[model samples]
Target: MTKIECILRPGKLEDVKDSLNKYGIHGMTVTQVIGCGLQKGRKEVYRGTEYSINLLPKVKLEIVTKDEDVDEVVKIISQAARSGEIGDGKIFTYKIDNAIRIRTGETGEAAI
Candidate 1:
């Protein structure tokens, strides 16, 4: 199994989720996060005072799938999250040793 983690712009969440659903990959965990990368954050002005916001809001999606589906899943996420600009975020994959569904007591691929 493989675990795919995607960090994307908050505005792109719905697009990514819809794309994944169309591809039949539905189970996932979504989280609101703060991070900084190549975009290096941004500057803001509040009450006439300028400030640097180094950490930006982001949306994180975690999905676990069979190993063979990794490539397609990554492609779907990439296409959906891209904006032709910096801070588009990143995607990462990790090998999953095992998975267990607590309620059903299912394991391996079945558990996912």
Candidate 2:
């Protein structure tokens, strides 16, 4: 199995979710997060002064799927989330050892 994590602009969440559903991926975890990279954050004005906003808000999406679905899942997120600009976001994919469905007591792909 594989776990795909995507950090993206908050506004793009719905598009990403819709695309994932279209691709037959249903289970996911969403988290609000703050971080910075090449964009280096930005400056904001509050009151009459300018301040450096070093960390920007982003939405983190976590999806787990079987190995064969990795490419399609990534493609769905990429197409739905792309804004052709910096800070648009990033996606990370990794292997998952196991998964369990707490309520149903299902495991592996069935659990997913």
Q: Name the candidate that leads on TM-score.
A: 1
TM-score of each: 0.96, 0.94
lDDT of 2 by residue, 1-112 (tens): 9999999999999999998888787789999999998778688998979999989999999989999989988988999999999889999999999999999999999988
Give each model's clash number. Answer: 0, 0
- Give every collision pair in model 1: none
Quote the positional error of residue 80 for candidate 2 in Å: 0.8
Once superposed on the true structure, which residue ranges of model 1 sit more than 4 Å away at CA? none
Indicate the residue-level lDDT of 39 in model 2: 72
Model 1 lDDT-worst window of ten:
34-43
The C-alpha local distance difference test score for the whole of candidate 1 amounts to 0.96
- Relative to the unseen true structure, what is the C-alpha lDDT of residue 70 in candidate 2, on a scale of 0 to 100? 94
> What is the RMSD of candidate 2?
1.1
Best lDDT among the predictions, by candidate number: 1
